[model samples]
Target: MPARPHSPCVEAAPNGSFFHPDVKEAFMNAVTTEIPALAHDAGVPPAPPEAHRTADELRDIPLKRLVASPYNVRRVPPTGIKELALNIWKVGLLQNLIVHPMKVGARKAQTFGAAAGERRRLALIYLFEHDYIPADHPVRCRVVPVEDAVLLSATENEMREPMHPADACDAYRILVEAGRSIEEIADLYGVHPKTVQRRLKLARVSPKLVDLFRTGEVKLDQMQALALSDSHDEQEAAWFDAEPYNRDAHAIRRRFVRDEQSFVSNRVAKFVGVEAFEAAGGAVRRDLFSAAEDAWYRDHALMLRLATEQLEALGASVLAEGWAWVKAMPERDHATRSQFRPVLPRRTEPTDEVAKELAAIDQRLAEIAAQWEADDMDDEVAERLELEEGALSMRQDEIEGSLLVYHPDDMAQAGALLSLDANGEPVIERGLVAREPVAAATTESGENGDDDDDDSSDGRPARVAAPAVKPTKGPHSERLMLRLNAHRTAAVAAALAQQPHVAHAALVHRLLAGEYGHSTEASALDVTFRDHSHNLTKHAPELDDDLAFTMRREQRRVWGGVIPNDSDALLRWLIEQTDERLLLILAQYVAASVDSVRPDERPHAINALIPALGLNLADAWQPTKAGYFDHVSKDRIVDVVSAAVSPSDAMRVAKLKKGDAATEAERLIAGRGWLPEHFAKAEVVRMKLWDVPAKASDAEASADEAEADEPALAVSADDVRDDAAVAEGEGMPPRD
Candidate 1:
């Protein structure tokens, strides 16, 4: 392989250098040699022997006498005329022009139409116009009947190399217009429906460019870039910017390029403007293509690659395991890593086993038929019996026909013999299919003591009775009646009502209509509480837990000493309050002290405690009773409480959600006698410090990933973090 040039593309950066010289050389060599090698490997399969007279027999026929076969039309290559003219001028037409006999009533003005060799027809015209060949050149045209020409043309197109994507799109439209199904067209073209769809997308691109693509002057990747634009003007602009020189050529190769991050960012920023971008309403503050979005795309793409690799590995492993019999299995149905099952050797041929099972099924069918004949029958039952008989026959045919069933033992051993119906009864059967054979004379009655009733004697055959239907009931009463042992519903309700956030709780007289709304009776209690709050507002009253609901002495002592007295800010303050007990519980379960868990854990703990805090329970609680707390801004609570405690201590306290006892204890340790300013600064520095190790770990992982794909020069999380850390360490904020 030749050495790779310092610059592969003309527009590469001045500083850019060859990163993988060996791989680049190999790739270039493969590009030039692979196609011809593949074509040679395919070899030439002989076409059917000539169906009609050779081209020389029809040389005396005038060009004007020939007409095209409607079935054989294909797009003529743009350079085809030149190539054909040259070929004719030198060696003459090596491949004879295939033509059909003209219609009997053809007018004098009628022009010759191409049957198979449209390229040769066009080339002949070019030669004649240039005076390189005589206007009445004795062309060697293959003469065939008109009917055979049509069939030949259709078969030729179907068996040939598939059309280009642009050609495919136009072909699909033609097929559809001619009343062909999408599936039929897809099958005929040997492509997926989705592939056809993408071709259609290419076709939908600007008409002017479609011609360029068809002519092969433009590449697919460049066409993709043009298609990305919403309008012709934008497409022209993007095309000019991406491919300044040889625009048509670039359009053909557009898929090779990726959108530049800086370019996309600048475009968006200009469209929205910096001030408006910042001021955008709720949840629109982030970039349209966010870091999270990019991360998701990368992760998903990586997973897909890994999954494909694993599947390929499993396929190789399966082949190595001497599973030669099933080697021709479809790729789609081949066992994946998760689904891999050992292929055990079988003792008997599947057909022989199925035959044996069928015999036994026949025996059982004899018994069932005898029993049915003994029972009284009706028209409805007779009709049902006929339907069942037909179904059984179909199932038997399927069992016998499917390649899925191999050995007789496979039917039972594979657990595929019997299947439960909708009514939870085993109705569908696979083993040996029980049907008509049971009534045959070869099946002896005394051998199995099974019945054999002849249906031919009577006009009406014995029919199987349908199962009786259950009567329907009215809609369920609007109540949940819980019948319990020992515990009373009222006692549980009372216990629930005594909680700090509960204004009232009682046994709901009627079930709530909506999923989460309180019943009318419980809603009355809320009304009473609201009235009480309104009355107390005159005296600037607040939520006095003692006045609202009684509590145990220990609970009161815990809250009274730690919880703030500002009831007006109870929800926010409650968020700030974190119980030491819960932290200790978490610390014990995780086997880690409060200070040891990573910074991310602080948020996780706070999220866990939000429900225990009795905040945002209504909005956040899902139908399944799981919740996401959002009563107060998490930032606000973290900031306010951090002012009075160490960041580590604050994190622990916030995680607790039980009380603020630990935060108070931290204040005592500092010996700061209400010196809140000092504590605030300590918390900020400590919190920021905890993030350092995490960010460093992320950077390390990213660096490792980038190293694996060393020559690609791809942007990744590690690259971003590496740059960010450098900026931050140098006393500059990281750029977005």
Candidate 2:
């Protein structure tokens, strides 16, 4: 076929250099049949010029090396050093560092350092810090005279790739400090004069951010933007957070210095169809001082113009109407959040009745689906084959009408033949063949025609014979399985519903209620809880006497606990208790129980329970419980706390319990000679209900009796029945 391929061989080139198969192959294919000397020439980019340092003289250098150089110039920057470090880590360093000689009292001595690859130098330093290499290992470095140091450093930094912006800035700083003009630095670095100037501007940035820029944490644009801030403090603060700093480096020097913005206006302005500088200026003007009426007017006019143009383009009548409404709105007026345009045409809310009916329909559909699945295989097969309800019903009608068309025998034969074909290759007829008609016999003759002896001897229709049925083959129909799964779900649900506890929970009634509940409430009220424990003993009936006693005692408590017809002291005690213990209990219940209810139900439930819990305290107390104060009093409950308290002390409570609301008379008078006196009198009318007692105790008997004793004891109803009943007696009226 083809000449056998030669076995591969490897050898050094004839030039006695690096050995490689590709090089050898290329050598064989050369124009003159000689390995080209230029093969390696086009190979690797020159390994950077050998670093001229003493470290280079060492035969075995540590994997990572760091040495200071006398030739170091801050103007030179790291270039391919980061890449060189990565390469050395992966392939091992093949080159040495460069250093320059220093004179100590005229005796020349070499000091080790890196000439090029500042990034590599840092990376090696990182390795040393990270303990990647042994601390004491010596490294190879190349040495040169002190005069060649600057050249070496510059060549090392500049020979490969490019310097980062911060590095470039560093280099420029070195040159400037050395008496080189910005122009001269620009020419040497192959940068524009402005570039050099901009770098110098970067050099003025705070040291923290300058270092961040050096490490590339902050981009050049971000640094430029930070520099543009009008105040150094502001720029430093913004830079500390790495706020969205962006500035056009190419921006005019005057504008860059004057701008205070952190974002590059031009970049975003381009998206909105304007120059960024102008956009930024406009934004600052609009945002900074639109408070004065004149400023507001000017800004409003510009906004109106732009808005008007936008609306005109929409051209829809609805939009125009909306715009008209917006324009007609008053300026600076605050409206309650509830006031809003209607979202839809007003219609009476849906009645609960209709929702119940829809839910019932859903349940019925679930029931029907379940019934179909529980159907027999024959029915299931018919279903799988998609035997429609109407079709199946019609077939049954046809079967009852007469057994002329299909007989059990014919189906059995067809099934057997189908089975034979499935198991092995049954020779099916190549051409269609008509089956012979059965004799003058009963329907049974059509099926299993081989069973001739079972037929009537007279060959007439036999009343006793019926066609044989075939067994269902293969997997059951999917329709049947689906119906079965549905039935199973329903059966389980029904069984769960029928459980004893389900009955105790009135589950069926609840389920029915839920049918109505979902439509009315939009959620089912019935809930199923998994049982983790069972009742150990059957519930026992209480003895009649015990039961009666229990009911009577509960009744007595309920009535006794009612807000008692009491003297003013008793009423005050009750009110205070409601503000404290009763209120807290009610609150805990509301927080736990009421909150568990649906959102719509919660408001209604709370409203119904509010009066029952005696929480209709004057609006003054609402702030104490729901707003800011844990405890508030008449005058002390001002918008701001009027005084501080030590834990062990009791202070006079201020009478202005109604918080910031100025008293009605005081608000009306505004200023009057009698105002302070009237305010003092009003404070006296507000009481400290918290001082009232809840129940009698040895320490609280007088308070409790004063609070809970009947007002009837203080007044004779016959003496002044009508007026006495009007006010609970404390020299006023008898309690109801």
Each prediction's whole-model lDDT (CA): 0.37, 0.35
Regions of candidate 2 where Cα sits further than 4 Å from its true position? 1-167, 170-228, 231-343, 346-705, 708-736
Q: What would the per-residue lDDT of candidate 1 be over residues 536-581, giving only the tens digit for each residue?
A: 1112111111222112212322333233346776567655645543
Q: Candidates' TM-scores?
A: 0.19, 0.22
Candidate 2 C-alpha lDDT tens digits along 441-486: 3332332344334322444222122222232332223332222222
The best candidate by TM-score is 2
Model 1 C-alpha RMSD vs. true structure (Å) is: 35.5
Q: Model 1, which residues run further than 4 Å from truth?
A: 1-165, 174-181, 211-218, 222-237, 241-591, 594-736
